[model samples]
Target chain A: MSTLPLISCRGLKKIYPLSGVEVHALRGVDLDIERGEMVAIMGPSGSGKSTLMNIIGCMDLQTQGSYYFDGVNTSDLDARELAALRNKKLGFVFQRYNLLPRASALYNVEIPLFYSGMYGEEVKNRALAALSRFGIDELADNLPNQLSGGQQQRVAIARAVVNDPLVVLADEPTGALDTTNSLEVMNILQKMHIEQGVTIIIITHEPEIAGFCPRKLIMRDGKIISNEISSSDVRSKEV
Target chain B: MSVRFRVLSSFSIDALKANKMRSFLTMLGVIIGVAAVILMMSIGQGAQQQVLSRINSLGSNLLTVMPGAAGQFVRSGNVNTLTLKDAQAIAKLTGVARVAPTVRGNTLATCGNKTWTTEISGTTQEIADISSLEVELGRFFSETDVAGISSVAVIGQTVYENLFDAGVDPVGSEIRLSGISFKVIGLLKSLGASSGGPDRDDTIYIPVTTAQIRLLGKTDQSVNQIQVQVQDLNQMGTVQDEITSLLRKRHRLSDQADDDFNIRNITQLQTAAQNVTGILTLFLAGVAMISLIVGGIGIMNIMLVSVTERTREIGLRMAVGANKQDILNQFLYEAILLSLTGSFFGIVFGIAGSKIFSHFAKWSTAISIQAVVLSVAFALIVGVFFGYYPARRASRLNPAEALSFE
Candidate 1:
């Protein structure tokens, strides 16, 4: 890999003004994540984890910051350019799975590829491959509401990596699942990391969820207080 | 970009299908508006055509001079101040081609065991040329018959049908009129119902001399109306002025006497009627356009609701890779599809509705291809105009806020 970090940010800050009162969500956050690293950001409510995720995902503009993805500065891009950058380089998974209610799982998985300029039968094939990788290709034609929670998250993950994005940012990927389904989803992410060398950043408040990631960052009051690397690989195949 | 647009359009159609009933209800306004406008426009055009055709039958480049001032209270054909001498004087005017003096009287005619009441128009041989009256079979009165007061007549089509067999020639047949047996010398072709006037085919023509002295028993040389044919249509006004001056001089009428005559320019009246019909059509179309606007508003209303309801979906699409333009295109296509679909059905129903209306209402309706094209084009304009705001609103949404929205 290149010497430059895969994800880097300096002096990131986000502020919101509500009816004349200033609410600072993130204050002077600085971090660097290397390539092929599976990391988890663990923080309680109002800890700015989701805000940081949104900024890193290029879905929102930062009030004051410099962010670089794969060594390209993000602060210099316009809205359309930022969208293009996100389309080509980044993928996101939300806590709720955020699949279009009207589309089938296969179409949901094809969304990122569509943005990445894939067309027709090729897009369908890539989407099917991603769905099968998660062992949920049989449910590809089912809508989000038709699938179980675990199946829905599998479809969401399939969508997140369909374009082979440089980094996948999943916020609370297993937040809505029971313990049995949660472990199943964590195993898929683990398989993606080891087999495909995909970089992933998952945000969660559960310690159990954080334990699955090799590296964990604990945040409090909009700042990371601790960054830990565990030597023991947590491998429990529940599927 | 083209592929993206295709996908977006398909998604728009899918979105519309998701709320099938709402989309259809939104399109209802456009359908009714287009149908009503086209129907009224066609009917108005048909009426104008009918009036113009009726007026054409009176002959081209012709003018009528009657005895009194024309007004709402002044009825034609009763003024007795006009005379055959005045007609003769007008006939001599420069630019006047021919003149036919007419003295009309309702008379009863009996042939064999049949009797029918028809107007007897006492006119000279020039009446045929001045009034576009054609002799379908046999011949009109010769100059010998008119000058000699011969008791010969030409029967109109309705008169021939009433007094004789359908296919039998009535030319050589003799019929008794006011107890006088006059030989029918000609058969005039049919002239159907005019604008609001009596059917021309229901009249019988006789020599003016015979009707004045032998049948009606009038000593005064008076005529009801004089039909004058001008040499050129462009010289009508000058010919009319010349006739007015000649008649005034011959009658020894003073300047204040109002000419004791009225000149009717049939073509002028036709043009005036055409203009009135055109304005009426425009007025009706304007009212119908109001309904189209209302229909567009209905589309706007529903699209706004749809955009708001699908906020989360929009957010998800943006998160995946869609830009603002993609969202805008998808919503705009939905609106356009609804209006265009409504317009198609509107055109079909408009044509069929006009046919049904004409059949039962006894009013003529002509569906012009321009109207169909214009309605469809206008419907497209309405779709773009009303659908833009909602689509823009959907596009301007912040993806982060939208995805988080419930």
Candidate 2:
């Protein structure tokens, strides 16, 4: 790994179209996330971090400025290109876990593989492998509601990373879980970063949750207020 | 397209599984519509067949030349005449097999206190052979009676029952009609009813000369109508053509002048009847197609509701890299699958309905294979057509907004 930034945004802007008005969701944003780095984005509601996370995830297009993912200029990409990038490179985890209701854990994990252009038994094998990695293979036949909140988030994470994407973008992955479940989910994200060498981004307003990431990006009033080391792990590794 | 179709079928199966009751109800609409088409076609076909058979019982090779025109009002005092000479000329033509002159009228006949009102027809022995008659008693009027104007009559089955209440031998008995007496020659076998509602077996066949001279007041006049039979059934049309032209020439009419006679061929009439029934069947099938369209609309509606319900799923799929085309393909496939399933059930229902209708309603049904194929194809097209907008709406949805929806 040459330490190339997996995701870099320059002067990003997001303007919400209201009824005969423009709501400035993000005036400008600049971000850099290197490969193998675990980053946390912290902000209060309406601080534009959600908007920033959306842009980084390629779930929504920006109104202005450029974003680069794996050296490819994302701002210039069309809708199809954005979809391809999302499937091939980025995995998403929402606060609700966002597993398809009534779908089995195996099927939930197989979703990306289904869309990843994989065919036949390969999709099933890959999905099974991904579920086993998260230790949810035993619950592969269980529905989302059948699993515990923490287990559901683990299944969601397995689903997100099944395509072996460049990054796991989790937006408050533990927001709906209890303290114990939240800790379990945070540990899962940490394992993906530390053990599997997968770059991970966690967006949250809690410093305690942000403490688990090696790097933290804090946002306030549509701007990055702090971009600094949050843990001693990355420094020790660097030395 | 294959992937699209697979996705569509899967979604349709899911919809059916999720809302089994609604899916079944939707299928009912298509079933009724398809059934209606076949039912209507069968009824029309049955009527047409009845008409054709009625004409067939009249003998396939017979042709009748009437002096009255269709759709024209006749002046009562001015009688339209078709001479017996014209009948002779037609009888001499190359394809002519037989010819008979006839006059029709009503009169009272009495034999020993048994009196009845009946039709008295004046014709020769050829009438017996051409009309497929079987003599119940005695014998038919002969050539000698026709040539010599013998006062003899052959009564039908109904005339025998009414006039012979005494159980006397009708073959040798004398009957008085219109104050004129005639010896019974023979009795005709039954021939049921004609399309005109007159009992064919109720008429009395009298020698033409005797009918003109003894019973009615016509002492000397050309025969009123002539029935010509051709050598072969197929030659009837050509013979009729020749007869018409000959009649026109005999009448010394101008080129523009309309002929005073009408030549009706039973086969031609039967063909016309068949055509009418065929058209009616097609029209019924067409009406059924409309119901199928309505059924397709039903499928579209349910699919649209399904798409709305699965908005979040759509968003999730989009996030997982499903493009607009993929989304479009998925929903479109869903629509087509629904209609195809409906079509399958519709065909089953249509056949069953037709069978039940024919048995209960006494209708005749002919289930054409083409109808099934056309119906299936139509349903699929309808699924696609009606399903298009909803599928498009689903594909056009923004992932962010959809994901946020409950």
Candidate 3:
């Protein structure tokens, strides 16, 4: 594998402005991940793990930092540029699924395609292919409210992968589910990383959830405390 | 997404449907406002037209002389200081059609066992010709009575009924105005009441010379007014100039000084009445729009609440690559859509209400195209005006805090 990183961070810091005060969310963080690497972030409450994730996901700007995504430096990028990069190079999955309440599973997956301005049968084909790959293709017409928590999570995963983004970013994707459901989500994430050769990054406090990732990183007091390589569990060569 | 209007339009429709009762209430405001404008304008227009037709009935092309500092005057009912010679001179003018000398005053008339009070006018054969006095019994006072100052008279239907004890033909019957006996020679047609319910038939007429020499004897050379008629409408300006110069020279008023008399065409009065209706309609429309403004406020309140309720949804959108402008546009689209739908229903109600009112009012009503167009535009504008603040607040939400919002 090339030594060049798909995502690189240098001296990233986040300070929030409160009334007559300032809140330091992230302090002096430096990190990187190679292309096609699967990593998990573990942190306690108020550890600024979510803040770091927001910055990395391009949903927020770092107060002081340099972030290079796929070799393009994001220091001077505007809000529009951040959204564009997030749409094309990054994907997000949340614990609550966050599918549009009025839309069906298929429509939820097609939202990324709408932003990309892909028209005609092409958007449908790509959206259907993404859902079918996750084995939720038969439930494509069901609304998020009509689906089970695990099924909704599966739909969210399909939505994340619809654009074939460079990195899949998940924030406690299985935090609201049962153990069986949690394992099912982890298994899907592992299969996508290995089979599709896509980079994956997940944020969670659970050690077992981190165990499913090929690498693990822990944060405390807004600082990364440990970074370690974990055993890659290649559960399937096909399927 | 490609064509911004279509996307925004669909979203607005959804907003309108989501709050059915609120949307209907907003529409009600618009309906009442627009309908009032139409109704007020129609009534005003109808009344003005009726007055104009009455004035025209007095003479085909009459010009009334009013007392003014100059030629500019608006009212036809005001008393003036013009006389019999002025009428004669106006008739002799190059573009003159004809002229009628008129003397009007309030007086008490009495016959045997009957006494009635009403307006009394002393006029000539020209007045009879111009006023279209139908001879229901005997002939109107002729040139003989005017020239010879005979005591012959013509009476309106209302005066004949109230003042005459002898129901027989009033022709040759005697009556006294200020105690001078005059023979009633003719009866006028029943012109009915004016729109305000004043009895137009409650009056009497006699030859100008007879009233001047016998009844309303006075040394003042000036008669009350002179009614002049032009041959055609296009000849009015020339006749007006001739009358102006004549009056100015007679009164010895210089070019720099204003004339003591004013000349007005009935057409101008008609136009002025039309303008009054137009202004009334505009004022009513302005008042009605207040309700629409209130409706817009309701929309803003609801939108603000919606933004607060969907904070986490906004955060999710931002995280999924939606920008501030996109979010702003989304809410604005909803606002415009709600208002547009309201305006549509308002138009429907306004037209229906106007139709129902016109039948009862007995007035000719026409829906103004400008009012309809302006109201719809205003409703949409109200949407944009009131819808902006909440949408801006939504777009300005902090992503981190919003995401963490429960």
lDDT of 1 by residue, A1-239 (tens): 26769989898998888799988888878989988889999888888888888888888877898888788788877767777767777878877998888889998898777766678999999999999988999998898899999999989988888888888899999999999899888888877788888888999988888887889988778888888897745534213
User: Which predicted model would earn the best lDDT?
Assistant: 1
Q: lDDT by residue for model 2 over B172-195, one digit each (tens)? A: 789999878889989877777666
- What fraction of the correct interface contacts does each predicted structure contain? 0.53, 0.64, 0.40
Question: What's the TM-score of candidate 2 when only chain A is evaluated?
Answer: 0.93
TM-score for each of the candidates: 0.77, 0.87, 0.91
Question: Arrange candidates by DockQ, highest first: which order?
Answer: 2, 3, 1
Question: Compared with the real two-chain complex, what DockQ does model 3 have?
Answer: 0.52
The per-residue C-alpha lDDT of model 1 at residue B345 equals 81
Regions of model 2 farther than 4 Å from truth:
A1-6, A18-22, A71-77, A195-197, A231-239, B68-81, B108-118, B157-170, B194-196, B213-224, B245-260, B286-290
RMSD in Å for all candidates: 6.6, 3.7, 3.4
A1-239, model 2: which lDDT tens digit per residue?
24547888889888988997998888888888888989999988888887888888888888999888898888679888889888989999999888878678998888777666665689889999988987889999999989999899998888898888989988888888898888777877887788878998989877768888888888888889988885556434432
At residue B49, candidate 2 shows an lDDT of 75
The runs of at least 3 residues in candidate 3 whose Cα sits more than 4 Å from the true structure, single-residue gaps closed, are A1-4, A17-22, A231-239, B1-5, B15-60, B66-81, B165-168, B196-198, B218-221, B249-257
- What is the C-alpha lDDT profile of model 3 across B249-334, one tens digit per residue? 87788779877887777777767766776676667677777777887787788788878977987776666666777778878887
What is candidate 2's CAPRI-style docking category based on DockQ?
Answer: medium
Q: Rank the candidates by TM-score, best first.
A: 3, 2, 1
Q: Considering lDDT, which of the candidate structures 2 and 3 is the better prediction for this target?
A: 2
Which model scores highest in TM-score? 3
